[model samples]
Target: MKYLVMVQGSQADYEAMRGNGSAQSPAWTEDEVKAMYAYMSAINDDLAETGELVDGQGLGEPAGTRHVTLGEDGKAVVTDGPYGETKELLAGYWVLDCASLERVTEIAERVIRCPQPAGAPVYPVVIRQIMEGAGDDVC
Candidate 1:
């Protein structure tokens, strides 16, 4: 079965991210960015070797999300950027094809231990099974 592992962070935890401070601080140093990429690459390699990795990538910060809601009139109201509390922001994700939920959980446990930028605490990953479906409708 296919599973999506979503990485999320709390507001306080995200605020503690060291490299680039949220619009208030400078960008990450070369060494810091390099270290983070190295860690991610290593993890990707491990996943590939284990035949669990379907596809994955690191995502930019959550400043580009858009939110859409319905007004009282039932018209669509669109808002720019992250509309939810920063504490519930999604960081990144990985899609994996695992043999079972137990295996997926095991993989997530390892992913949770992957390295992060200095001062950036390890983010938590939530694993969810993807149900088979037709077109856009899930079964």
Candidate 2:
């Protein structure tokens, strides 16, 4: 089955991250950035070898993104960054085809075990099954 794994974060958490910035930024130490990326790259390599990984990518900070929705008149309504005040915002996602939910859970667990920047907590990874398409007649 195919699944979409969503990674979310909270506003307070993001604010703290923003303060940490990239290694190029004045806020983060070079060692800290290097360790973070090293861990991330290792995880990517593991996923590639597993064959369960379909596609995955990390996103830029949410402050640079926007949210758009349709209003009652069907016109587009745009909103500023991060979309909502919810405790979690999507940080990144991965789509994978796995043999069973057990397999998917294992993958998620591995992600949590991967190293992260010092002081950064493990973010939740939500797994959701994709809906299969019906024939044209169903529509």
lDDT of each candidate versus the true structure = 0.70, 0.70
Collision pairs in model 2: 9-89, 10-87
TM-score of 1: 0.74
Q: Give the runs in model 1 whose Cα sits over 4 Å from its true position.
A: 10-18, 21-29, 117-119, 134-139
Give one digit per residue, the lDDT tens place, for model 1 in 1-139: 9999988754343344544455333345667667666877887898899998999876655566677899999999988764454546677788998899998898788777765544555556898887766447744
Worst 10 residues of 1 by lDDT: 10-19
Q: Per-prediction TM-score, please?
A: 0.74, 0.74
In angstroms, how far off is 122's CA in candidate 2? 3.2
Candidate 1 — number of clashing residue pairs?
Answer: 0
Task: Tell me how far the alpha carbon of residue 138 in candidate 1 is from the true structure, in angstroms, after superposition.
Answer: 4.8
